[model samples]
Target: MTAVFDTFYADDTLVDHLTKSIQYSIQSGGKRIRPLFLLETLQAFGIPISEAHFKVAAAVELIHTSSLIHDDLPAMDNDDFRRGQLTNHKVYGEAQAILAGDALLLDPYLLLSSADLNASVIVALVAELAYASGSHGMVAGQVLDMDGEQHTLTVDQLKKIHALKTGRMLTFPFVAAGIIAEQDDEIVALLRQLGEAVGQAFQIRDDILDVTATFEEIGKTPGKDVVADKSTYVKLLGLDGAKQALTEYLDIASQMLTEIEHKTQLQGEPILKQIERLRID
Candidate 1:
């Protein structure tokens, strides 16, 4: 994944400082959960991991990184640090940071198009990624999140917000894997369902961590959601309730994996292991 990013920015045509700023943000530490989930899903589908698969995973990570860069800007979370380092805006100035984010966000399409895959598969990945990260998906969720800061949000409302924001991006990896593997529509649908369950579980765990984890534990400022009065699973549900919600989502994910395996006779243990790793305990 790092090699993919390094090679992408190695071109001499890009401006020096702009390229440096973008590289700095991409190179900064992150869990790389999106790409990891993606690659794992492909493996579960019995697809041999190759450079083309890596490119698709890299595209997903690029989008995630762009979202993080923008989310930490002054107009958003206004954080000074991310991943225990200065936020992109803090290090590169807001203008350059915005440009860096824009590049990351837009470059994924180019990366996807260039991947060594069938045109139809590449098209599916591109469309799914765009919708997942665009207005009806992540952006819509971000709007709901900001609005929720102004007033209390019900549990259902909070779920809807996250379903679009966090869930869509997380869900894309499974869908992309199915596409790359040329699975039947039924199997692809099951993968999407599994992805959604994992996505929701991931968000619930994050909400729990925001309240409980230390700066070192989370690699960022702790309690920012609480400070901003943002609606979260923990805010709507009590701590125990939030944990229960997390468990329920994980169970759903597990069930989906079972269903997929039963239908396809393919082992889903790799994806299940990735899902289990999200559990705090």
Candidate 2:
């Protein structure tokens, strides 16, 4: 993945700073959960790991990293650190960071289009990525989050926010795998449900960590949710309650994976195992 990112640029002289910024953001340490989900989904379908798979995974990572860059800007979370290192805006100037993020966001389409796959597959992937990352998805969640700040949000409101902001991107991997495999609509729908459960669990865990974990443990500033007065599961439910919610979501995700495995008779336990890694207790 690092090698793929490092060599992704062309005509470096004209866009050296942009190239470096993008590389720096991608190289920053992360769990690479999105790409892993995509790969694992493909593996569940018994699809062999191929260059096309790598390309798709890398594109997913690119989109995720791009969102992180923008999310750390002064207008957003306004954080100084991410992934245990200085945020991109802190290292590069804010303008450069913004441009780097923009480049990252747009470059994934190019990567997908250039992949060695059928035109229809490429089109489906591109459309899914766009909807997941665009105004209708993660971006919408961000807007709602910003708006909900300082104001208390109901459980339904909070879930709706996260379903867009975080859930949509997470759903991309499973849905994309189904598309690539040419699975029927029913199978793709099941995958989306599983991904949404995982995504919600993931975000709830993040909220828990914000209140419980230290900076070193989380790799970013902890307690920002409180400081920002943002609505969160931890803030709405008590810490114990939030933990319980996490467990429930994890169970839902696991059960969804189990059903998919039984229905398709596919090796989905690996994906279930990945979801288990998110458990806080």
- Total clashes, candidate 1? 0
Candidate 2 C-alpha error for residue 125, in Å: 0.6
lDDT of 2 by residue, 116-197 (tens): 8899999999999999999989989999999999999999999999999999999999999998888889899999999999
Q: Flag regions of model 2 displaced more than 4 Å.
A: 10-14
What shift in Å separates residue 279 of candidate 2 from its native position after superposition?
0.5
lDDT of each: 0.89, 0.91
TM-score of model 2 relative to the true fold?
Answer: 0.98
In model 1, which range of ten residues has the least summed lDDT? Answer: 265-274
Could you tell me the lDDT of residue 172 within candidate 2? 96
Candidate 1 residue spans exceeding 4 A from truth: none
